[model samples]
Target: MAEPRHTRLRRRTLVGSAAWAVPVLVTANAVPAVASSMKTDLAVDVVDPPYDLDHWRPKDEVPVYRGPRGHRIAARGSLPPSIRITNVGRLTAVDPSGSVEIIIRDYGNDRASSAPGRLKAGTTNPSVMWTDTTNQSGAKYKYTCRGELRPGQSIDIPLRYFVNPPFLHAEFNVLVAAWVEDQQEGDYDDNSLRIGHVPWISVF
Candidate 1:
């Protein structure tokens, strides 16, 4: 049976519309999938230990000294440790304005307590103070960058502190960590660096 001219014209129009709608629907459904796959890659790398174990130990064998008030005083040791944090990922990491946080933990012998240290921020010649001592083992540290850590770039923070001589020869563990305060990234396993078994000597 022969269809009317207007009817045939309308049928062709509907067919063309349906053909164009298929790809549009398919693309619309795929958009969520693509967006879900998009993720922020944030990673950190600790470059190296700034000072050796000998740097913490006293150069001479003497460890104790008599104070002015007849009290036993332990020898003083200084640590100027440098910590480097590098972004080893593809995407850039960002934090809120003045919200990036860095933490350092020093696990030393029980006989001696390690004091909080001051930190200088930079990559080569760091001189700006950016850390505050929070406790015996931790500090609230800041990085020099304005809030963005780009891929393959690094920031160095130098720490200076004094430690009392231990009761005997003991080992100290230093751990450094950093992160963005309100970042949405879930994985933080790589944000910390551990340099264990740093030796401290106390000679009686």
Candidate 2:
């Protein structure tokens, strides 16, 4: 028996539709693979403020009025602390163009304090007072940079903070936390680093 003209036309239409569907399915599956391969993996590591110190003694000790005994005292002065961040990733990490933001937090329970200041990368100044949002858990500061952080590339930031009267106590602790922004992180655990229970002392 010969096939009818309408049946033959329907078969040709189905064949044409199937031919286009094959490429669409294949493309859908291939796009995710290509995107996954291009993803940028970034890791941030804090390279300053040594963690294993038996004790971080004050550079200078000043006696305050006897209000509370055994107050972990920071000299009534300012300390210049150096913070270092490095990109430990296989690909380059680029911050949003124009400015790079770095946030530092004090996770210690005693009291909240942070000094915010802008310093050029690789430069240190003792006069700059690092200030932070009052009573906030963390302080964020932005800087101008090239924004391209290649693997293993590191930048050092200099910061300064005044040793106010209230921060002097025997158990006073100055915990420092640091992180970078604008990178596709592989492990979020390594994106930020914290050093806690640092002895609150003055380094003038």
Q: Best-fitting candidate, measured by lDDT?
A: 1
Task: Report residue 36 deviation for candidate 2 (angstroms).
Answer: 6.9
Per-residue alpha-carbon lDDT of model 1 for 62-88, expressed as tens digits?
A: 122322122354433222245454554
Off by over 4 Å in 2: 1-36, 48-81, 96-138, 142-144, 163-171, 196-204
Q: What residue pairs are clashing in model 1?
A: none
Model 2: lDDT of residue 32:
68
Q: Which candidate tops TM-score?
A: 2
Residue 165: error of model 2 in Å? 8.3
lDDT of 1: 0.36
lDDT of 2 by residue, 1-204 (tens): 311111101112111121111111113365767544543343334333322235543332223221222244334311224545455544565651111223222334433334422111222333222333332333344433345656556665554333343332332333334444543433342333333232334422
What local lDDT does model 1 show for residue 21? 10
**What's the alpha carbon RMSD for model 1?**
23.3
**TM-score of predicted model 1?**
0.40
Clashing pairs in 2: 70-170, 71-169, 71-170, 72-169, 72-170, 115-130, 115-131, 116-130, 116-131
Supply the global lDDT for candidate 2.
0.34
lDDT of 2 at 193: 37
TM-scores of the models, in the order given: 0.40, 0.42
